[model samples]
Target: MRAVRRPELRLPELRPYDGAELEPEGDYDGLEFAGTDCSGQSARGARFMDCALRRCALDETVLSRARIIGSVLSGVRGVGTDLSQAMLRDVEVSDARLGGVQLHGAALERVVVRGGKIDFLNLRKAKLRDVAFEGCVLVEADFGGAELERVTFDDCTLARVDFSAARMKDVDLRGAAAVDIARGIDRLAGAVISPAQLMDLAPAFAAQVGVRVE
Candidate 1:
């Protein structure tokens, strides 16, 4: 297994952010930023707690080293968003389009991503615990060198998803609608899947060991 490239996220003392300009190292708690256009905004090292960000256009937004907790993000379009080294906990994101999102070295706990399209999501070297991706389409999502514990994919499409060098424990894919292990199928030794999924992945599994089915 390869070593994970972890980021050193050191946030200073947070103050209040009023969503006026580019505020770094600010704290935004219990705010309702619904139906707002916060595109191209930079909120590095900000802490958001119990916030509601529904129908917000956050395209190309920078949220590096930020911490978001107990937030609900529905119908948010965050294409090309950068969330590197961020920490998200107890957050529910639904009906969002987060293509080309960067989440390298981030930590996610008790997060639920439902009914969304997250193509080209970069989660390299991230830590995910008790995360559920339900009814989502993750095309070409990269999880290389990520640490996953108790992560589940429920009725989701994982087409061309990469799991190379990922450390997975108690990861469940029984409810996945489509599974495409683009790389590192051998490294998923501790993953749990249903027998039906196993049957569906038999060809890939056979090809991995250089076995010929006659």
Candidate 2:
């Protein structure tokens, strides 16, 4: 299997942003949003390039259809953060604590997610390419109808993930710490897993094929 390409981010000197409130369709470039509370703010269709969001709050922040490129989000905490239909490229997200986030129809490329705990993430119909998730805990993440290419899960815990109607190519799950699929286990056509993982999922596989083990 080919290795997943990681994001190569080189952030320039950024100006500190002390903005009062997020504006819709705002254009922010080379800015650092440090310790900013952006909860319940609407930044829909905003564009953020070469930016760093460190220790920022994103609860219920609307980033739908937003474009985020060459950015880093570290230590961000939030619930119900919406990134639906957003485009993320060459981004690194680390140590983020999020729940019930919506990311349906989003496009992610060359992104690396590390050391984060997320729950109830909604990624239905999203497109992912060259993405690597490492050392993260994901619970109840939905990937229905999503397209995945060159995606890898290393040391990550996937619990109750749904992949119904999802398409995959070169997806590597061999390094996952744990894996649990609540639905669509038969849709793993182009995914790679370890023999131990296959054994662990044998019951599910048998159930799918209607083979009873007595």
Candidate 3:
């Protein structure tokens, strides 16, 4: 019964940017861009509604195809922020210090990323639905070919997280404390982990199915 690849955000009926200087196709509504700097701004196709961006710097900002609704990005210090094909709905990114944030083909719905320290966050081919990354510190976060649904990674610290060719459904890392999967463990087929994260990833799934657990 796989039918929850949601992300068709439609929030572009705005005319209230009220700018203090953020003008590259700008259409921001209900704006409150506190401490705005918008470093190296491009902001292509920008359309943010209900916006509240505090401590904003947005270094190397591009925001391609942007469309953020109900946004609230606090402590924003976006480094290499491209946000390719962006469409984040109901977003709430707190304590942000986005590093290498490209987000290729991005389309996250109901996103909530708290206590962020995102390092190398690419999200290649992204399409995450109902995303939740609490207490994040995602180092080397790639997520190649990503398409995760109902994504959850609470208390995260996932070091060297690549997940190559990812297509995880109902993805949850069981309140992740320390997940160090550098590449795809068979793309984490139908991911929904518990049981102590499958016994702490069972020695990297028994060395990728060549089991010899003596």
Candidate 1 residues 74-173, lDDT tens each?
A: 8999788899999998888899988899999999988888998998999999999878888999999999999998888889999998999999988888
What TM-score against the true fold does each predicted structure earn? Answer: 0.89, 0.99, 0.35
Distance from true position, residue 110, model 2, in Å? 0.4
**Could you arrange the candidates by TM-score from highest to lowest?**
2, 1, 3
In candidate 3, what are the lDDT values of residues 1-214, reduced to their tens digit? 2333333334344343344656677887766777778788787878988777888888998888889887778889968989888898878888898899898888988788888698999889889888888887989999899898888888889998989898988787877888889788779988877888788888888988889888
Indicate the worst ten consecutive residues by lDDT in candidate 2.
Answer: 1-10
Candidate 1: residue 152 Cα off by (Å):
0.7
Give the top-scoring candidate (TM-score). Answer: 2
Decide which is better by lDDT, 1 or 2: 2
Cα displacement (Å) at residue 162, model 2: 0.4
Give the poorly placed runs of model 3, Cα more than 4 Å off. 8-12, 16-37, 40-58, 61-67, 70-79, 82-87, 90-99, 102-107, 110-127, 130-141, 144-147, 150-161, 164-167, 170-182, 191-207, 211-214
Candidate 2 segments exceeding 4 Å error: none
lDDT digits (tens) for residues 35-135 of candidate 2: 99999999999999999999999999999999999999999999999999999999999999999999999999999999989999999999999999999
